[model samples]
Target: MVLKIGDARSMYRKFKPHLLMVLIQLGYTFLNFITEASFNEGLNPYVYITYRHAVSGFVMLPFAYFLERRIRPKLTWPLFVELFILSLLGVGFTLNAYFASLRYTSPTVVASMVNVISSLTFIIAIPLGMEKLDLKNPRGMAKVIGTLASLAGVTLMTLYKGKSFRSIWSAPIHMGSSSIHENWLKGSILGVASCITWSMWYVMQAYTLERYPAQLSLTTWMSLIGGAQSAVFTVCVEHKPAAWIIGFNIKLWSILYGGIVCSGLIIFIQLWCTKEKGPVFVTMFNPLSTIMVAILAYFVLGEGLYMGSILGGIIIIIGLYLVLWGKENDEEEVPMRSS
Candidate 1:
């Protein structure tokens, strides 16, 4: 049976956000590996982040110029300041903090920390008056439960491996107790900082889009500003010229993938998503990355998938459903409530 074009367009409109988010998470799964490899090879996290945003800034600048020039909002001093602060919160602080944490700890630790961002964003949103919570309502309860479930699922995935699967490598994924070495505490702290800054970025991005309303232009501005801020922060602490130098290697690949796919394209998509949906809605999919990482690790790295990982992935999916369901119900009620 053939589908009508109008019907297909309707379906696309409905599922576009979900599909884009899944693609973004898949891109990030590779990012987890590439960035870690680059770090392992002694790439400075600060320098890498600076280069990434700078590359992303340039990559996006032309698109913003050609596409958004006619409709773009006037760049007032106030709006420029807002963009600068947003960039500082989004990439300038979060990326460096996250990569710095990655330097001191395993990606698993970082992933676990990231799973809590939805909850953090929800909490921040309430006080800032972006979200409403009425525990008596099932809709509110669903959001609360979903956040808890995701946190539980990620914790389970990170800490437990009930059984190992026989993969192509037939090798068991051994999560060592001592994998997180010296400065583990420091890394944990930094990871937590990244989550907080990232949540703030989401909230701020939502607010910024309301004012500016041009996703591509804002992405370009934020990228350039974030890169400049990160460069300044890096230079203040990291003065070693040798560390900043790079050639055609894994480091360059990491920067390109992160800049082009992750930041340049994905950041623009995320801003659009956050504008269409609320900040919490955009964050609700964070746990899916852990599941994707597990799948990719099994196939690409030959890491064995265990019972805990399987269970965690299932719970994460269920939790994500609850969040989305509640969000839809809330939206449906908004008009009725207002009337």
Candidate 2:
């Protein structure tokens, strides 16, 4: 009887992290849908990002001072340097690249390319020593197969290239701005570059978590620093007084929602999930975000979902499950403790 009980305990232990991971993915899905709705409405993506970070930074400050400061890990020079780099990679460069891409490509293209992160994470994980690849194992085979399947899905979605304004997919299609077509190819390249940069950010976060281990605290500090940096950059690049001004009540509320709910809270959840279940696990679940965004965009942006997006999303979902199953198989079973 004791042995049976012990075995049951061990099984539960094995599944615990995976359970937490699913919950985190669900939370992110919710946030992604809301944020997508928010962004589709006239808000400039960079301006949106800047405000989100600023609010997140503000929200994090008191919490860090009161809760984390006393027990905060000592900051060595190397860690400080890494902290700065992380802010740059995860927040600054990634957001800039993402917005730049959005300026040129359709959201569908942007969403499809995000699938690249799973493959990118698997590749980048090797050099960082964050994850090991067992080239000979069934698990390894699954991961590779899954990654390729996802890439194929992206190709199908992008290459099919439905007409801009007259699609059967959604509502009255606005093929974005008229200027987009003039530079659509360049925008597509930039969008993919954004995906690569964002993938690197995920890997960096995983690497940093190993050293910092304090999820909320680290995100808070990074947000503070990143906010300042981005704000300054926006001032130089946009140089539009109207964009910077926080005048109307609606604008104030929007900034607060973006910053606190989307940025600060969402980031805390992301770190917790990644740390618990591993980075690839979290990345694999990101397709849920795309699905959520699709639904929200339909209602909010009146952007209809085409058969292509549906088929592509379904393919991406299949690929995600493949990768996750591969990861699960890769995990070794360990003995568990008594209650």
Pick by TM-score: which candidate is best?
A: 1
- Error (Å) of candidate 1 at residue 206 is 0.7
TM-score of 1: 0.92
The backbone clash count of each candidate, in order, is 0, 1
Off by over 4 Å in 2: 1-44, 161-183, 249-253, 299-302, 333-339
lDDT of 2 by residue, 1-339 (tens): 999999999998876656655565455554443434344444555676788787898888788767776667888999988988888877777776665565566555566667677778778886777665776988777787877777776666656635433334554433233343246777678767767877787888877888888777888878877777777777777866666655555446667765786567767777877787677776776565566556556655566556665676678778877777777765543222221
Q: Per-residue lDDT for 19-58 in model 1, tens only?
A: 9888888788779878887777778899999999999999
**Candidate 1, which segments miss by more than 4 Å at Cα?**
1-5, 170-181, 337-339
Clashing residue pairs in candidate 1 (N, C-alpha, C atoms within 3 angstroms): none
Which clashing pairs does model 2 show?
170-304
